[model samples]
Target chain A: MHPRLTLALTLIEAVAILAYAISGFIEARKRRLDAVGTFLVGFATAFGGGTVRDVLLEHRPFYWVEHQTYVIVLFVASLFAPFVLRTLSRLFSERALLVADAIGLGLFSISGTSIALEAGMPAFTATLMGVATGVFGGLIRDVLCNVVPLILRDSRPYATCAFAGCWLYLLLDHFDVDSVYSLIIATAFILIARLVTFKLNVRLPH
Target chain B: MHPRLTLALTLIEAVAILAYAISGFIEARKRRLDAVGTFLVGFATAFGGGTVRDVLLEHRPFYWVEHQTYVIVLFVASLFAPFVLRTLSRLFSERALLVADAIGLGLFSISGTSIALEAGMPAFTATLMGVATGVFGGLIRDVLCNVVPLILRDSRPYATCAFAGCWLYLLLDHFDVDSVYSLIIATAFILIARLVTFKLNVRLPH
Candidate 1:
């Protein structure tokens, strides 16, 4: 991956982590869980996907080693969880969750695919890793909450967007396209596809 | 390992897989998810940890391969999920979930440790595999559900029991004890300890 692309991914990752952490905090506080619940959910919601990606790729010490930003983001998110949750009733909705998660899915798919290519994984494997990284965290968080996974559910386009964007990235890479161009194309595809599907109730075939 | 112990594990595993699959079905139904949702979560609830363990341990085909019984069990559980759930609900509660999960923890820890040893992994690495085998399934399920992981949380004893059992098994194996005795001792130790912890609401100190 190009240096500029790498930098772009780092920034997007930072934002995605922060966004998901906030979502987790809001969820925990709504349950009236104590501090531990907030932090635990926040941590999982933030790092779960990336951690799974890293471990599967056999990356040592994990991604948390390079950046403490995710941890800090979760901490900061947890601190304001109570206050934010109060206003969440106005600002948060199913539509909002879809948007935030879609943004996250785009960032994670790009980053995971980029890392897999850097690690010399095959294009198909890279795409699979990208989709896994983008979606598995929320899946884990949902399962623990005793809810149906968003990705596995019939009514959601979560994994479908990730899968589409991942394939786009890999196909672009195979053509030796510029990293930034590939990323922009893939991210836009994911975000637009996700938003449209959510709004229209489009779902994958059974 | 003795045939008796193997038989015992197989029986427990069959029940556990069916039980977990049923839980997944209940959640999927609550969301009004389609057949895909029911099957996917059922698989995750049953095979998530084992898949993670096999992938991590570099074992191919996975445990669900030889014993297709697990698949049959998951299918049956899904088909009759509504009836099974009504019956299960009368018996299932927070306490029941914990107990069933604890049984899975012990069985997974013991069997995973034994497999690691058979593969000639180092003792510590074997222990790690044991823990991974025991926790990864629930971790996957929780991620799918988009909630905080119980293993990661301070909620009761989970991974620690596996760790202790791993070490105990290692010690017995190192002393050249019969593998049968070692497995029995380790599994019993973990199951009893986990049950006690759940009963007493014992938890790890932060």
Candidate 2:
């Protein structure tokens, strides 16, 4: 991978992690959890999906374990979550959260799919892994919060977008598209699809 | 390391897995899940703790993956869960379920702690890992059932027994006790502690 692409991916991942952590902080606040509980929930939300993916793939040195900085950042942020999130919520509207979360869903899904494929998983299983990577953090968050997972209950096309994007990534890679371009395109595809579906209130049939 | 001890451990593990799967089957039935959902829940309940332990310890070829027979058995049992569990429930009293679950908690916690120690984890982390391994399957089951995990909400001594038992195992190992004896002693400690606590209606202070 080119240094430029690696750098870009890292930045995007940081954004995604931040988005996830904020959601966890918000939920923890809603539950009136203590600072420690807030931190644990925030950490789980930020790292849970990647951790689950790495575990399933039998990969070592979990992403959070590898990136101590992310853990430290989340820890510090969680300490002041109640105050920090209040200001953040005032600055960033719900639309901003939606955009950030959509981007996270896309990038995490494609990256997870790519890693699974590289690990020689079957394509179908790889796609499922992608969806898992994209959604499992929130799933864990909801579980910790004692609520039904949004992906399972919400009719919206969250994991569906990731699923379609993963297949698109696989298709592009199969057709010999440039790796960097394939990633960017598939991620963008998911992001746009997610936003469009949310805007249209598109839902799966009951 | 003796074959006899290995066989004994394996037998205990099978019993534990059956207990966990039965709990999951019961929960899924209560939730009125379809056959597929029931199977997934059963599989998770049976394997979730060990899988989480393996993932945390960076162990490969998950327990269920290595023991394909277990997966097949659970799969087959899940297919007939509604009828099978009904009959099993009639034959086994609630006391039976409690006994099996306690045995599972003991075995899984000690094994998890032993594995973590072998993996060179610090003692505190290993003890937590043991508690996680003992409680996580039921935690996952509750999550899938969209309920707060029993470990988190219940003021029972479930995870407490695992935690204390793990420390006992660590102490025994530190004293150079025979490995088989250490395992058996620690497991028995947890099993008896759990059963006694339950019978006495022990509750953590609110």
Candidate 3:
């Protein structure tokens, strides 16, 4: 891996984790779960998809297990979430949660697709895995919270955004596009698509 | 694996999957999910735990993916679930579902523990993985149906039953008990524990 590209990927992962954790925190608060429940949901939202992906691919040393420091950081942050959330309730609005989740979705889609490609999986399977790696975390989170999963019920283009972005990444890679360029374009596409869909209230038929 | 042991394990696997799928079908009917939804929930309940176990153990080709025949079998069965459930509803009462689930829980607990041991995981980790393999499918089923997971909420000996059985299996193995004998003893322990708990209406305080 190019040093510069590795650095970029790492940055995206960090940001995505933070974004997803915040969204999970907000959802946990809405349900009035205790500290343990809040932390569990947040952890699941941030890492469940990748964990599943690694498992399916037979990868060892799961991301969270490999980076124990990240788990420690998340734990410390979760401990203070309730107090921080109470103070910043206005700024951390429902829209904010959607935006954070969208950002995570975009970053994860690119990362997952790239990893699957590197693993030498077939294109269709790689794309499906990429979408699964992007959306399964949120799916797990919603299920843990005992709600109809948003991806299943909401007409908004959630998994669709990830699917589109992943396919774009795969297509660009096939066309001999530079890795960094493809990553940026794919990620931005998903983020923007999600935001626009939300703003315009665009929905698929129920 | 010994030929007899392997045969026994395969039979248990078949029975456990069927039992869990039936439980899942009942839950889907209770929620009035359509055919697609019914199949999705049933698949999750039947396969979710083993999927998690295989992933954590870095096993490849996921059990269902490897055995596409099982997927087809389950799909065909799920298609007829609503009709069969309607006719069998009175005979296959809620109590029957519990019993069936308990049987699955016991079988999965032993299978997971044995597999983990074969994979050379530490004893404690193997034990925990065993319990996870026993209970996670049902947990996924409950979550998808927008209910608090039974293992997490139900006061009865749910996960506890699996945990106890797994430990029993591990201890018997340590004592050089015959593999077949140990598996049967452990599985029976879990099945009996769960049935007795339900019969006595035993529950842990919330």
Candidate 4:
């Protein structure tokens, strides 16, 4: 909770939100949704997971509500969704977007798990909370887009990676490791594992 | 609230939950999901709307969490889903199900609007909250079933009915009417309107 670490986490969260929003924008456009629908889908993709986590933990003043700046940014971005989408695609490859999303998944999962544990949830429940935080945004986006959630259908081990990462964070915390290092290590573990699995086409067995 | 009125509202809510859960059961069975998946979907349908309302209003210990019996009932129902489905179909026609669902929509919408108003939200936001609570359970069900939400795709006057009903309740409350009477009037208005519109094939023009 040092000032520098807190600042770093906030920056990473912003990036993650942006990454998730881009996917929402793409899907909304594909569905030919209007500006309002586009903005809503984008907002949900960016904030849905955290919102769900806060709700389950009975936390108040939702992350988006507290960080009104994020809502404003998304609103403005949504106004010129086409232009924003073009600019992002031009600046970053699909691979880069995937990497950013993976980092976001890692950070969100660990944070959610940590918060649940602090709320006195058992380890199993906390780990599930972490996974929910990591994946619920995309799940909601797909629902809005009228498709099966990719996480539910895809065999790329997305939630599994989050599950592992959450357990790692919990273990480190249990051993009284410095939280800053534990957070970074667990996040990196998820990020690397996600990318590696996606590349190798590793899948969960049906 | 009078004890009798409180009991009436609770009973209405239970019926609403059961109706919503039935829809989930049908969808999950159609998808051929396992017992666990069926239970999860049923639980979501039964509670998704109220849960979303609670989250938005920052209400704690979610309705389902507070009413553990609901969870137990849904779990047991899920275990005998096939049998329940058969029994239900035999006992009630499709039209009967629609009637029950419409009544549920009315009750949930009015209650949600009333709750939001109690929490100090503006009229417009409270109305939206009501519509959300009325329709979200089915929305989640359709999403989990990998289809566009019926509310989004159907031209039927589903959410519109909820919207108008919420306004009616709000107006009555603003006029200082007794809540018990207002609740009954608004819920009946929605129920009758929904059934009539469905019968007449009312469609919102795109």
Model 3 interface DockQ: 0.16
For candidate 2, list the clashing residue pairs, or say none: none
Error of 1 at B151 (Å): 17
Clash count for each candidate, listed in order shown: 19, 0, 0, 0
What's the C-alpha lDDT at position A90 in model 3?
68
Give a tens-digit lDDT track for model 2, residues A1-206.
Answer: 88987898889888888998888888877776655556657877878898889988988766775577787788678768777898988999999988988988998899999999999999999999999998999898888889877889899999999999999999999999998899999999999999999999999986
* Model 1: per-residue Cα lDDT over A1-206, one tens digit each: 77987788677667677677776776677667777778888788777888887776676677776777668766765777777666765777767666766788897888788997787666655776787788777666665556665567655677668878988888897899988888888987898898988788876433
**Model 1 C-alpha lDDT per residue in residues B73-178, reported as the tens digit of each score:** 6655665666767788797786676667667777788888888878788888889988888877666655555567556986677799889988998899889999
Q: Write the per-residue lDDT of candidate 3 for residues B66-172, one digit (tens) a residue.
A: 56666667767766876767766766777776677788999888888998999999999998999999889989888888887878977887888889899999999
DockQ for the candidates, in order? 0.20, 0.14, 0.16, 0.14
Compute the lDDT of residue A118 as modeled in candidate 3: 86
* Least well predicted 10-residue stretch by lDDT in candidate 3 chain B: B31-40
Which residue runs does candidate 4 get wrong by more than 4 Å?
Answer: A1-51, A58-114, A120-146, A150-206, B1-4
Look at candidate 1 and tell me the lDDT of residue B200. 85
Error of 1 at B88 (Å): 25
For residues A1-206, write the lDDT of model 4, one tens digit per residue.
Answer: 78998899888888888888888888999999999989999989888998888878887878888889989998999999999999988999999999999998998899889888888776766886787888889889988888766765465688889989999999999999998889899999999999999999886532
Instruction: Single out the weakest 10-residue window by summed lDDT for candidate 1 chain A.
Output: A142-151
